[model samples]
Target: MKKMKALIVAAAALSLSALLLAGCGGAPANDKKAEDKAPAKEEKTTLVVGLDNAYPPYGFIGDDGNLTGFDIDLATEVAERNGWDLELEAIDWDAKDALLNQGTINCIWNGFTMEGREGKYAFSKPYMHNEQVVVVKADSGIDSLEGLAGKNVMTQVDSAALDVLEDEEGQKALADTFAGGAAQTIGDYNNAFMQLESGTVDAVACDLSIADYQMAAKPDMFVKLEPLSTENYAVGFAKDGDQAMVDAVNKTLKEMYDDGTIAELCEKWGEYGITIDNWVLVD
Candidate 1:
């Protein structure tokens, strides 16, 4: 009877030990299995670009009613190459500074000018050359800047052309000779051209590339005077915004230039005077 009790007790102890060992060992195995079944997810980034939707050859609404243009295509390519999703925000040209500073948009990528704005924003390296000019009716008999005297000349509000014309050391003296002693401001190029077509405005000061597009689209309707001022196009970020992003864009632009991608884009927008020969990426 004693031996039987001892044997039974030993058997129970062995069974309990086995269960304890199984519980401890099975828990770790199950945990490892669960860990092996799950994977860490990769996060994707979204790149938001700001532009003037009415600005053509850079960014504009197409015949299909979708946003399309050189800057749009270029931004799309940059986003794709960087494995990012792209979002284009059409903004009021005059409100760009506020939007950029307020974080409403990431960066201004449309035919954004770099000169006279260097101190206000962190800009990518100049990618393309640009010129500011005045467009008039082909037969308006206004061949020179001096001819703009006492005429109602106009420019897009908050534009580089406006900057040039308003500069005291630049064209301000010439603008002072106009009817208002300054250029009238409009909301957009489309409106500026509309006013020109209706003969409400004597001339429209604008970028050369945009002028070229307008001229090509409506041949003989308008002609541009000699360039008022020359400048360069660049991507603009808020002065306090991401410098890394600017560096990334600069690097990508150079890569594009080297790999013939920029040349192709230039060819696509060649009608607007965007040619690889004008691309400023060297070495």
Candidate 2:
């Protein structure tokens, strides 16, 4: 009888130990609940920036073969500040509109001109000033816009120069007088310069800063005429693009400018002669 009692007591002890083990397991359940209530990290949005990667000091492949430029740095900072990913896409400059319309890129963040392009896209505030200019061979004797009259003139396709050439108030008449039907448009500036080199074209109209860059590199090869028309540079989004994004970028850009980020970048690209230190956004 005593043995039987001992066995019962042993069984009772084992049952108690089992209950304790179950309670310990329940503590882990509470831990799991706590984990479930923790906040989840938000996913980042990628701001796919489209640009003509050949344009230097704005967006271009650097000596190290990585894409680097003034605009690139700003875009990266804006993306980081807004918790968005930065994506650089080198696109055909002429197809910038199509790319934006198709949502292939979020915005054109290169050296995009905003004067003639008003109402074409949702535009960010102008960040800098630019000018259209003519480039000719050193001995071409084209010292002014009038010198381009009746000459074979070419420019990059879809460039601000071409837009100016087409605008009635701009240089439309001058371009019409060129030997060709209109200003010959090439896919890139390199080819335009090549045409000028080969004497196939008498002159090339392009952005003043780009003309300066090319002239600086080949000092004895080319000469720039005085600016044809001055214009503002801004970021371009599709007409129906995300307004929220436009507002966000503009806010961030203002912050950067106030904090001197834009000034520092301008100084960094000072050799390119592009700066926005005194710029005031029209709206």
lDDT per prediction?
0.90, 0.86
Q: Which model scores highest in lDDT?
A: 1
> Per-residue alpha-carbon lDDT of model 1 for 23-90, expressed as tens digits?
88878898899999999888877778899999988999999999999988888888888888889999
Stretches off by above 4 angstroms in model 2 are 1-40, 276-278, 281-283
Q: Quote the positional error of residue 283 for candidate 2 in Å.
A: 9.1
TM-score of 2: 0.83
- Residue 18's lDDT within candidate 2 is 88
TM-score of 1: 0.86
